[model samples]
Target: MWWFTQGSCFLPFFLVVWSSTSFILSYLIALFRRDVDVLFPYISDAAANPPESCIFGLMTFVSACAGMATIYSRFKFVEKLSEETRVVNPQLNKTTLVLGILSCIGMCVVATFQETAVTAVHDVGALLFFVSGVLYILLQTVISYQAFPHESSITVCRVRLAVTVIASLAFFPTVICAFFVKQTDLHRVKDSKDYPFHVASAVCEWVVAFSFVCFFLTYIDDFKRFTLRVMTELG
Candidate 1:
């Protein structure tokens, strides 16, 4: 019952499953309607398409839930550390918690304001989600290393730290390149459909999304150790 709280390890797996399924399904639906070129359309384009937009909105809401669950899990981990040492570091924990909450709220905003309905609000929400994601990755990597310094894999925590850094670094330029190309294609190129630059931008966007998802793998091993208890017996 306690593990059923927001911090449940199962939450990450659920987040991953729902987010991935919704994304893939939205893309497929977009393709079915001939509204987007599956190979070249931006992920957001799927959300802009008819019917599939519903799936996209669902994904964003699920993402928001994942973010909140992450905050709770991180808070619990910090509390565990403090309990062991009999000392609390409120500032760092609080900062991480706040960032996670902001990231979740950003996802909600993105969901509420679809790109077709309100481009500016959607863009702002997306930016907030991503910027906070980058910061959260950096902070969590540091926290993971400091929290579990002794993990073996010649240091599993260190490997995960490296991965988080690399993924975020890769995400940074891809997002910028994608945004720049998309903007240029929309305003200047005019023949944006499946154009080389357009395709490149789409690919970059995909890479950024994938890299962010991969960042969560840093917690996979830890998730394995989480305990779950049954609270009620079947009648």
Candidate 2:
């Protein structure tokens, strides 16, 4: 049941991220499917260009933006800490993690306004899915890492290995999709086939996401254990 709870959230979000990556890539691939699609005299078509560009721009913008906001908003710890030394205090660090989660929530506001741009106008639905995908991994990492601090042998040594293995396992799904999505001929599928390089680049994104999930999970588990132990001691 525990594993089920873990996998339920993990698999769904994995599919969500995979679908976005695949959908965008397939669109790009169609852009280059034909034998001479990218000819020099090629006239740019608004119908083909705008919608797809909007699709990508909206999704990627929302995606990367949400990811940035996760990292950036949490950084406000510097402001709240009001100290230049970068000292790590457990209490303050815990507050930082809490604020980080809030930042993830704040991404919703930014996502809602994506439609202010042309590309994102009709595709706002995609942003919702993108936000979930982004948050799942972030929250998953927070769950994983909040437990034990970096100084612990369990976290830095043994437990870290287990989490790394879990992360490495998560990449196969995205990597598999990225593999079939790549093609060298862009002109042929000018409106279809994804770029050969893009397939590889997308894999890098999945890796970061998987690692973030692993770390976040650690944080949550550690904190939960700490809380329970504290309760028992008090009782």
Candidate 3:
């Protein structure tokens, strides 16, 4: 949707090219290596193609939309913290602000590409999306750590640490999608039946979806509690 990503017809884009190459290489690495055989067997889809999409589409849309919501909430949190706090570590605010916007941009870009650009940017944007989610979770954790109460960045640290682990766990399937690509029948935008890829995609989305749900339900309280305790200490 943004100019940065649109109308740049086959610009020999460095990132996309790098990603495609990485896919091939990773696949080869898995193929030749014995360990990867075991690994791939676990991750690989036994089914010929992904399952039907009526339900899958809804689930994908919901997870993606909820991810957008969580990122938006993060933006509001950062804005509030920045105005309330002084310049102790302004870089934290800057990173959170920029990455939060990027998270939204990344999501919108994929949605748009998926809708149009049938042959061009669809999966490419999706790959970028995988990376974007990674960046989103990382930056959010950084913001949490930096804006944590000065008295005990420790508790916040633990929380962020947990967040990071969950985020990382949440990230593996995107990598799997990247690896399988069109080769994996389930992930293909066109009619494909790779059931395992679909299952993997579902699993990952479930993790991310639940992660954000827990984040909103639990971490909103954490943020509010942290803010109040900080203010009380300062007062």
Best by lDDT: 1
lDDT of candidates 1 onward, in order: 0.66, 0.39, 0.46
Worst 10-residue lDDT window, candidate 2: 38-47
- lDDT (tens digit, per residue) of candidate 3 on 1-235: 5332332211213222332333334334444443233223322221111221222233334445554444544455566666777523566656655664555455445444432225256456554555655565676666666666732266655765676678678678755754554452222343455546654765675455334334433343333322211234554
Q: Model 2: per-residue lDDT, tens digit, 1-235?
A: 5532342233323333643563445355445543224322111111134444444445544545444433333333323333444344445445544544443344333333332243243334333332344444434344334433432335443555565555445445444444465443324343555544344434443453445444443332322222111234554
Please tell me which model should have the higher TM-score, number 1 or number 3. Answer: 1
Stretches of candidate 1 exceeding 4 Å from the true structure = 1-7, 86-89, 150-155, 182-197, 224-235
Per-residue error (Å), model 2, residue 147: 10
TM-score of each: 0.78, 0.32, 0.49
lDDT of 1 by residue, 37-109 (tens): 6466777777785688877887778777875886677577666666676444657777877887887787788
User: How does candidate 3 fare on TM-score?
Assistant: 0.49
**lDDT of the structure predicted as candidate 1:** 0.66
What's the true lDDT of residue 7 in model 3?
A: 28
lDDT winner between candidates 1 and 2: 1
Decreasing lDDT order of the candidates: 1, 3, 2
Model 1's TM-score against the true structure: 0.78
Choose 2 or 3, whichever is better by TM-score. Answer: 3
